[model samples]
Structures are given as C-alpha cells and as structure tokens.
Target: MNDQMKVRFFKEARSEENFVEEMCNFRCQVRSDLEERSRLMSEIARRAPDEAGARYLDTLIDRQKRDEHKLVLLKELLFLARVETHERKLDKLDDN
Candidate 1:
C-alpha cells in the first residue's frame, strides 16, 4: 500500500526477470564457446605430441561437460523461480 513497499516489490519482480534473461544469454554464449572448444579440441588432438598433451585435452573436455551440467541446473532453477512468481500472482488474485 505504501510507495516504499511498491518500489521494493517492483524491484524484486524486475530483478527476477533480469536474472532469467541474463542466465539465458550466458547459456547461449557458453554453448557457442563449448562448440568452438569442441571443434578446436579435436583439431588439436589430431596433432597432440604426447600422452600428456592428449590427457590435458581430455581434461578440458571434461571441464566442458561439467559446465554443461551446471548450465542445465541453472535453467531448472530459472524455471522454478518463474513458476514461484506465477504462483504468487495467482495467490494474490485469489485473495482479492
């Protein structure tokens, strides 16, 4: 009812929307990076000098896999946040 409450609520709503948008952008960027890395990794592997070099490349590939997993979790969390906001809106409507 107060101006302060309205501002705080609006800011929270804006922040959540911003968060989802940022995450989506970051995920797209990371996906492109992963594609580039995968392409380069294979090219480098073809010319790798020794076992250690090959192993190091493998490590990089593994790290990329982990990053992909984290991105999936981030998307899930974003979805959950959006669902929570929707539920809150429905509850407010019911209260009215």
Candidate 2:
C-alpha cells in the first residue's frame, strides 16, 4: 500500500479499536452503577418508612430502567464493533 493508504488504514483501525474500548468501558461502568443502585435500594427498603420507602423505591426503579436501556444500547454497540472488525478482516483478505 502507498503511504496515504497505509495512513488511512491505520486511522480506521485506531478509531475502531477506540470505539470498542469505549463500549467495553461503558458496559463495565453501567454494571457497577447498577450494582450500587441495587445496594442503595436495598438499604432504603430496609430503613425507610412505608410511604418514604415507596417513593424512594419508585425513583430507584426508574433509574434502574434507564440503566437497563443504556446497557442494551452498549451491547448493541459491542455487537456492531464485532461486525465491523470482521468486515475489516474480510476486506483485508480480499485485498491480499
């Protein structure tokens, strides 16, 4: 490959790697956040008065749902990254 082609290929690969790494990091963060939220919910359930507990639980539940949605999106991103990586490998092979 010419210098320009090489540079383009390197940049693409670097960007893809960065995206995959970011998705992985996001997944880890979401998992950690969910765990902490769960712990807090449990603590509130144990200690709060019935009405207060109900309100807190509702808020936590909403947050949990949002986190779950974000997790799904992150999983989709990881899947897309895998697909892109495979396609890139195939293209490389075709070029050879």
Candidate 3:
C-alpha cells in the first residue's frame, strides 16, 4: 500500500476501534440506566401519583430506544469499516 493508504488504514482502524469502545460504553451505561429506572419505577409506582410515574417511565423508554438506535448504527459502521479494510487488502494482493 502507498504511504497515504497506509496512513488512512491506520486512521480508520483506530477510529473503528474507538467507535466500538464507545458502543460498549454506551451499552453498559444503558444497562445501568435501565436498572436504575426500573428501581425508580417501582418506587414511583408504590408512592408517586399514577400520571407522574407513567410520564417518567415513558421518558425513560424513549431515551432507551434512542440509545439502542445509536448502538445499532455504530455496529453497522464498524462492520463497513472492516469490510472496506478487507477489500483494500485483497486489492493489494491482486495488484501483485
């Protein structure tokens, strides 16, 4: 590979790894948030007004859904990056 391609490949690999790490961190945060929300919901259900508790639960659900969507997008991006890297390596071989 040319120097430029090599630099690009390293950059992309680093970026992909960083994204995957972020995705993992987000997943862990979501799990923790879900656990905390569940506890809050239980408490709210027992002591808070029905409407208020429901509204809070709905907001939590919405946030969870958004996080899930972001995780999926990041996974797809990582897959694409791996595929591109593989293709580039194959191209190099073909040239030789």
- Candidate ranking (lDDT, best to worst): 2, 1, 3
Instruction: Count clashes in each candidate, considering only residues at least 3 apart in sequence or on different chains.
Output: 0, 0, 0
**What is the lDDT of every predicted structure here?**
0.70, 0.78, 0.63
Model 1 — which ten-residue stretch has the worst lDDT? 1-10
**Which is the better candidate, 1 or 2, if ranked by lDDT?**
2
Question: In candidate 2, which residue pairs get closer than 3 Å at backbone N, Cα or C atoms, i.e. clash?
Answer: none
**TM-scores, in order shown?**
0.65, 0.78, 0.50
Q: For model 1, state the Cα shift of residue 45 in Å.
A: 1.3
Better of 1 and 3 by lDDT: 1
- Cα lDDT of model 2 by residue, 1-96, tens digit: 135433543454567867677668868998899999999999998889599799989999999998887777668767877799889879999999
Off by over 4 Å in 1: 1-14, 89-96
TM-score of 1: 0.65
Task: Kindly provide the TM-score of model 2 when superposed on the true structure, using C-alpha atoms.
Answer: 0.78
The residue-by-residue lDDT of candidate 3 on 1-96, one tens digit each, is: 135433544564666556445545645675677677667767877787688778987887787676566545545655666577577778989999
> Candidate 3, which ten residues in sequence have the lowest lDDT sum?
1-10
Candidate scoring better on lDDT of 2 and 3? 2
